[model samples]
Target: MKIGDLSLPEILKKTTATQGLCFDVGAFSIRLRSTHKNFIHTFHKLYRDFPVITDDQLIDFHIDMVIANNYRRWIKPQIIARIDGQQPFQAFAATHAMPLFEWALNWSIARLGQHYLMLHAAVLERHGKALILPALPGSGKSTLSAALAQRGWRFLSDEFCLVQPIHGQIVPIPRPTPLKNESIAVIRNFDARVFIGPLFEKTRKGTLGHLRAPTASVDCLKQTAAPAWIVFPQYQNQAEVLLEPLSKSAAFLKLASNSFNYTLLGATSFNLVKTIITNCDCYNLSYSNLDDVIAQLDVLSDNAQ
Candidate 1:
């Protein structure tokens, strides 16, 4: 029920309650466990939150991992992750939990995670339709996603749109999209609904935390959203918010490049992407304003419907 009450492994596994990842983090308790004990715990002291119910679960998937490493040779471990703190009780999410979560996401999408497949994308939904935002790190995809969600769209994921190959639709992996630097302030200033997670003091990626996704998005985990639009987002200075028409060919190329598992599926992956781009309205959106982008997307959806 709460982070401190449940054991570490139980917390992560609780995500199986839906079909996605679960998070049980706070100021006091910081521990994580999956089906294995290969996780590290950096912190050594218990937190003060005790049992305030800072637990989140995502039970929307079946995972698969292709683990290869020197450690595997000895005991066959599938994943490696950062523990809470040096003392072993404080959970520094980026250093401890997020990495494991990524591997878990990779597993949920497919039963494999070798070097060949990948994507730089985030997922969210409305009604039952899912929107996949595939863009690079600096591309303002997260900003657009957060903005859309606050305005109305269900936030399925800020990053990682898990594509279930057999079903041929994106699997919802709802989690906070990490917002760095000014974007954090931008989101907080933009909307009070946005749940910005605990901010770390200093790290390689600068300060980081999870952007809380709406609970409704996670609740509708079983719904299937047909790929409606494949829009590559870019935030540019001095640029007006506009969605540019993009050819299916260019869209496919860019999307594949952004994918996390394009090469892994080979022809199957190619066909999946082709079907998506073909059926979806493809575009290149450039904007310096969130309001402008949000308004245009709403208008576009209304016209499409």
Candidate 2:
């Protein structure tokens, strides 16, 4: 049954208890347990559309977020992330539990999901054509991604561009887009309908919040689209939107450098990247205004016919 099928009271009862709760997210099933009241409340709201596991289903990642230790609980109070009973990262303040969960899950997928050539990019699709926006950190990738997803575009993923090599198709890995610092306000003011989670402050990424993916996106999780465009988006302050065509060689190099597992996949990665670029138009977009870039993308997608 869908998580929405259960009431808030029911979700809290299942998750806060010792047995934990399992939910199916696209191709992966996560069994998460957290007793922290605020964390549970946030989880229930952000993931309400996902289906909860009711039967005996195998869980891919068994995770937990809780206050660590008995003595330290009286002190500054820190939260720990346990994956299969092993804690790999250092603890953070208990207040930062939500962003911690989001980052930890991303770490799990980036490290263990070897089947797909994962890229550090935000992906979205329209009319069976996918756009891969790969960029370095602080390039305004997440901001642009959130704006697009809030608008008319289909949200695929904000952090990962999952590429299945054999078919040369982009897998849908839709999840809440993590908006950091200024991006938090940017999206909130940009889209009135956007359902943003609580502001998580003082994390390593500064003040953070999560924009839940559109309901339409979660319902179409089974659909996969081929890469039809590759745009490297960079947000600049007070600068006009600029969209420039990029060469295949340049695009391939940029994509390879930004991917999580490009070199690891060897020749298979090389062939797939080349094929994607060859079939798609590559562009370098620098924008300060969201509306201008959105309009430009509309024209670009329409001409892709």
Candidate 3:
């Protein structure tokens, strides 16, 4: 059954009691438990489409969100996230519990997902090919990715680019796209059909909001896309779409810098990254208009055939 199949009270009861909610989230199977009402509500809304399993299955990340039980509990309650019985982050206000848990889960994956060559980027696929968008903060990577996903490209992931080094294929890790600050509004206005999670105000990264992955994209989680384009995107106000080709060596260095486990993967990582750039077109894209950028990318991908 899907997570949305259960009512809110049913989810709360299951998590607070002995039976936990076990679900498949792309490459990982996560078992989550929480008693806080707000956290429960957000979890239900964010992952409504994910499949829930009742079997005694092995889970990669076992997480619990609990209210702090101290003097501060009376003053201002906070929620703590414990993964595998270890707390990795500082306690956050109870109001921020949902985003905190999501943040914690991403952290757990980056630290524990050692099998793949993980890059901190946004990725999407179309026509059996993947578009890897690796950029620094404020580059509008997430915003552009959300736009592309809404415009028909299959959403892979907005956070991590999971690449199978041996095969040079991009694995789908379709999760909610965390839209921050103004970008949240940008996406909301861009796509009326997109489902966005509750607004998280004053987060460390500023006000945060999450866009649920498209149902079709999540349903095809097992499908892998071949690396076809490595494009670094930047958003400049009032700037027209500017696409410039990058040399293979330059693309390699930028990709390596954005990778989470590139150095850890050693020669395997280096070779895989090289093969991707060699087989795909690499470019730097800057634009202000979303439609223009999307059109440009469509033409670029078509030319690669």
Alpha-carbon local distance difference test for all models = 0.59, 0.86, 0.90
Better of 1 and 2 by TM-score: 2
TM-scores for candidates 1 onward, in order = 0.68, 0.96, 0.97
Q: After superposition, how far is residue 283 of candidate 1 from its true place, in Å?
A: 0.4
Tens digits of lDDT, candidate 2, 156-252: 8988899998798888878888888998888889988889998988777888888888999988777888999999998889989899999999999
Best-fitting candidate, scored by TM-score: 3
* Ranking according to TM-score, highest score first: 3, 2, 1
RMSD of 2: 1.4
**Candidate 1 ranges beyond 4 A from true positions:** 1-31, 34-118
Error in Å for residue 214 of model 2: 0.8
Candidate achieving higher lDDT, 2 or 3: 3
lDDT, candidate 3, 68-157, per-residue tens: 887888989999999888999999999999898988899889988999999999999888889999999999999999999988899999
Q: The CA-based lDDT of model 2 is what? A: 0.86
Off by over 4 Å in 3: none
